[model samples]
Target: MNVFYEEAGTFKVGAILADNNTSLQIEAVHGKRSKIKASAVLFRFDTPPLAEFMGHVQKIAEELDPNFLWECCAQEIEFASDALATDYFGHTPNPVEAAATLLLLQNAPMYFYKKGHGRYKAAPPDALKAALAGQERKRLLAEQQARYVEQLNQFILPEEFKPSLSQLLYKPDKNSTEWKALEIVCTEKKLSAVKLMEKCGAIPSSHDYHFNQFIWEFFPEGTGFGELESQPAVENIVDLPHADAAAFSIDDASTTEIDDAFSVTPLSFGSFRIGIHIAAPALGIPPESALDQLAATRLSTVYLPGNKITMLPDGVITRFTLAEQAICPVVSLYLEVSDDYTVTGIESRIELIKITANLRHNELEQHFNDDALSKGHLQHALSKELTFLWNFACKLEKLRGKSNDTNNDKIDYSFEINDEHVSIIERRRGSPIDKVVSELMIYVNTEWGRQLTDAGITGIFRSQMNGKVKMSTSPAPHQGLGVSQYAWSSSPMRRYVDLINQRQLIALLRNEPPPYSRDSNNLLIAMRDFETAYGIYGEFQRSMERYWCLRWLLQEKIQTINAQVIKENLVKLDHIPLVTRVASLPEIAPGAYVKLRLSEIDLLERTFHAEFLQKQDS
Candidate 1:
């Protein structure tokens, strides 16, 4: 006798070899033998062979429609498969027909649900319709994703992706169909998604990609000072006394936050009073004000190759910046120096100073360099003052016991962008123009740090020990700067830390209580947040500079380049601030120059491929 039975959720036909009361030894249709419980047997029949019976049931099951069967069944009721099969055929169903009916119901789980052995229940009409709709939606999405992949494989961007290009490039949802198609095509084509998209002309400008990614992460709301009401003009700003000396600032031509300026007044015999005036924004932006909160959150201005997001609003910066001919409110530091350039006395006060000129580094460096100073004459407007400050800066450097040897002799590259074209200008470190500005800023910062400590007030300081620089509320020596105590108070309009330090200094000078206490939570939090944000901003700037460097290479379109090996396989490209690794570098010593054949410049990934050519003999 052949028995059609369900075993472990699978239906099969087998021949009974040994009959027992509780169990039976049976051989399956393929002749394999097994023992099954009597309760597992659904029905037994004769005449038909086990294999033939199984084949007949499969054929019948294929002819059955699950939807038609579900519609025929009565809702809110359970019925046995054999009874349903008999009712459909208008007579008792054979073993094949009964098993075929069970198979159809089992395969269509969404249409019919199993209640027990040989029993079934039809799904509610509404639930079944919703499930069908979801399945259809998934099918349509699969079709769309296939189309996207097809287009991408042919190096064509689909029209649907244009709306979400930024999202697809920078931050993509992994579970999304667009990302899945992109991932598949990228792998198949052996290229990154960014490179593939660029090839399809989706990325109009690689520079925009880098910039927008930064803005998306750091300034999600966008880089605009929109609808924020500007604060009223600073009170008593013009009522302050106009100092006797005329001051001039030295900065890059593009600089807008003109923070620090200088003046030198000659005295009898060999004494002189040198004034270092800083733009005073802290007086206008009180702590916890709207502008103050904005600055605090940003911590510092975000600087890139050709653009910046100022920490303060444009109106506030213009009001406080020490522009030419403006009697600006300033925090002045006056130093009394002897003929030997030794600072005998120092004074700090709030005053008004007329900014006579805003010196551009491009113009000033030509006239105020070491060659010009040694000649003892410059025909420019600030020639005498510049010469005196250079001499005084040299003396100040000597007083710190810091030699020029500590200076890195490294090159500092500045980027200038106009009409999407980039020009990287190289400036030597430790130049006369750099020293004059750096030394005086250091002096003022050190003196103000000392003043804060003497007056028992708290200020944020930049300290270094064992070459590790950090920010802290407590005063510590900046070993690198060769200063006993260093507080950044020069660029209040640009840096939030400097703004806070300026407030403390102003309070100390006015004999008022300081805003941030020694162990204030706000002070510690600001230091922590500022350090993190500053590092992020610095990294972003370097990345953008690197991006522009790569663009410059492509713009110039010279395939052959020269690089000096810094170590092993890593080298710095000559004339540009780009460092990369050369896999083909053949075990060369550091500082050896090697010619390279450039290929495969990828701006999206900020990478390039280089092959080492013959080394050049110096």
Candidate 2:
């Protein structure tokens, strides 16, 4: 075979013609052609078009190829007489495309390194505190100038500079009410507060509270949230989640204003029809299109802690929350598959109708966990159809929705914070029920991603790095649900792309203008970037979660839990290993191990859970 390739259309050293007929000689010809033939050839290839070449090669006597040698050596360098080129100066940002890349880097197999380069190790941790303390000092000064900055390295670098009892108390609060009030502002600007506050070594103050206030910034303002406005009075009304006419508990009732409902019925062969109802954000949102700016800016709703900051205001997520009773816009997807899980059809186009999604996660969790609630309240108008789908494929269903159940590995913490006013049962688990629910969600998300990919539409997608990211890389498989492509569109209340995807689908369904560019390549690139940004969001969410979950975990005092390796790297015990910790051994797999280092609590990066992993045999 005539092998061919292209490299700037030129050749340099080591290009000697092989065979006794070919003395070690080389020549260059530009725009000139010459006829050359090797001894008898078993393969003949047409001169490859310029665009399709992989570099040129001719079969002369194949015997002339260099002898294969695999040699091991220590500390060796090959100096070249030629000028070192730019391509050699820096490595190509090798795009990683799979989980194996991270696995190889973490394990550091012998093949990944040469004989002389030995592993690097450092003493047990003294991780990231000195730096955090400096940061803490800076943030405190900026949050409140009046409060004397405590410079609490203890909190900043908990292990190295453990806080004294006095330092734990928040006393003599920031003199400026502005600091306190702005702290209440649940927006990124509050970081300005973190930058200004966090002074260490301070005594207790009445204002002391876990930094929960920051979460409010992530959401739209909710003044009358969790409250229902009355149009008139109804009979035998009970209390609602939002409406509290306590005195009028005389006859308070919850109204079901959800617009559309889903009906799924399993048919012969492995096929199911899906009905997706969506509430109109424009209805609750003012000026009809007023949400456009926010929809674009947020691109998607951001969820943190128990709080959710939606792209649109309460007027949308709730009032417009998908429901069957109220008229709503919806998108329906019907899919056919064999038991082996092959997508067979694209059924209905994106159909929009008024729908209700208010049966939200909590409500659903309750339906399964609470016996007294009865399954009736959870049933849809299309109960039979929905049940058929659930029965046929609850675990196999691809339209379930996106969420992580208790199974998502995390450092477990629960605070029996039985204060005079507050009592709560904190839970951090990767339990059975959680896994079942989460897996169902995974099925739906992955299917949605597939739909978008097939349509060549631009949209946001989410994927977890199967392991650590290394210098040379590829987009690792999304390990969360064990799927190739996982994305979300169930909620457009905040995510801009949800709206984009919804609009695109709506267009496709309505036979209107195509909302997304059909340029598959560009869309894929955008999707990749969106996924990367989502990773950053995950990190930020994890950092904040550590702060809150930590408070609860600390109060619970139930130390020790098993954890799994989300990513790992062999590092000097001195460095930090970034991962969430859980109290149960089940939280982590037993035999699986990865390089790790114990880290001082750095609330910012949340590097508290990375304890060294001992080899199982050890």
Q: Which ten residues in a row have the lowest lDDT in candidate 2?
A: 243-252
lDDT of 1 by residue, 1-618 (tens): 878888888988789899996888999877799999998888888856777887888899999988888988999899999888987778899777888898999888888889998899999999999888988999999999999999999999999998988789889888889999999999999998888999899888888888899888888888776654465535545557779999999999999999999999999888899999999998888788777777888899999999998888888888999999998899999999888888888899898999999999998888877777778777787787888898899898888876565454889999999998899999988788888999999999999999998888999999999999998878999988888899999999888999999989988877889989988876788889999999999999999998999999998996999999999999999999999999999999998999999988888889899899989886
Top candidate, metric TM-score = 1
RMSD to true structure for each model, in Å: 2.8, 26.7
Q: Estimate each model's TM-score.
A: 0.92, 0.42
Error of 1 at 113 (Å): 3.2
- Ten consecutive residues with minimal summed lDDT in candidate 1? 227-236
* Candidate No. with top lDDT: 1
> Candidate 1: TM-score?
0.92
Candidate 1 deviant stretches above 4 angstroms? 1-59, 71-79, 124-126, 229-239, 406-408
Error of 1 at 532 (Å): 1.4
Tell me how candidate 2 scores on lDDT.
Answer: 0.37
